[model samples]
Target: MNLIKPHDRISLAEKIGRPSVALVVDDFYNRVQTHPTLAKPFSIVAHWQEHKQRITEFWWIALGGKPTASYSYDPVSKHFLAGFNQTLLSDWKALFFEVTHTHLSPELASAWQQRVEMIGENLLRQNDKLLGDRGRPST
Candidate 1:
């Protein structure tokens, strides 16, 4: 139940071009990869080039575009595996909005903000639920 108004849910694929998405993904990851709290887990990423491509594809899909060919990364699993605690997720969300604000107009940024918040919160909740389940015995 996303309470976001229909008009606030503009298509990122249509409003923001793929080139802009690519740029944001590149810039965002560049910063994240070097971020003190984010760097270590990302160090396991063997190929920066491929990782960036996958990130771009992820943004493309998230922004309401058709799925990129074979872009199937599960963000929650990856983040959980990498031990992303609440503080790390908060930092990541903060940086994400900062990057988006730099690239988009206020309206577009606001629109994307709602969507991003919803997605991030959902992922965090799901990750927590799954982690909790892991500690319980199977039925």
Candidate 2:
């Protein structure tokens, strides 16, 4: 059996660090705010700075860094409320990949991108189930 467990492995948070993560989030969100398709969904975000900070923290913890602040991230509910359709999610993923690739090393970007795919897929599935039960897919 493998000696290193999932939690025991060196985290991407440690390797990529918070700075790079924050940089990507900042840049990506900036572009997203102005993006034709992305802008509409993101319009719900009241404060851009606050959103970036929280998202940066979210990614940091997701990549296995220790939490520096407490937060209750209800992403599925939020995205459902935001009316995130497949197109929006697809655009988000493409833009995110672009930003990460520009900001991080190829290997690091690939690693982080994989995690994003897994989480995003799960989010999409959960959001779809919830929204579908309500008799409509998010637009």
Candidate 3:
């Protein structure tokens, strides 16, 4: 009983809205903060409040919305600076997909995960350089 179909691209921002997006981001970060392997890399980020706010805006714009100033940070560089390795990135992706699938419809989750995988690929290719976001910048 899915509302979406193949080749049907909808506005995820409109589908999920800001509140749901916030909830997903909160849950994702909260889970990551407590993860045994992932927690170490994120431990340097003491400003969880601000990080969550910026990340929420990042997802909002990424999912399909007007880009806010807060969403302009380079995620790949940030992760590299946080000392994220390949295993950490893989675990992070797994956790992200788990959290996203929990919050979004299957169709929406698939679409978002596709974008994330592409971004992850580009991030690996760029090697700590800025890959930027999906909506405004090229991956």
lDDT of each: 0.80, 0.90, 0.78
lDDT per residue for candidate 3 within 1-139, as digits (tens), equals 8777744765777687888788888999999888989888888988998888998888788778666674468766776677655677689899999988998898878887887788777776665444335222222
Rank all candidate structures by their lDDT, best first, as comma-separated numbers.
Answer: 2, 1, 3
* Best model per lDDT: 2
TM-score of 1: 0.82
Kindly report which residue stretches of model 2 are placed more than 4 angstroms away from their true locations once superposed: 1-8, 133-139
Q: Which one wins on TM-score?
A: 2
State each model's C-alpha RMSD to the native. 6.2, 2.5, 7.6
TM-score per candidate, in order? 0.82, 0.89, 0.78
Better of 1 and 2 by lDDT: 2
In the predicted model 3, the residue pairs found to clash are none
Residue range 12-90, candidate 1, lDDT tens digits: 7768878888888898889988898888878888998899999888878888977757867778888778876667777
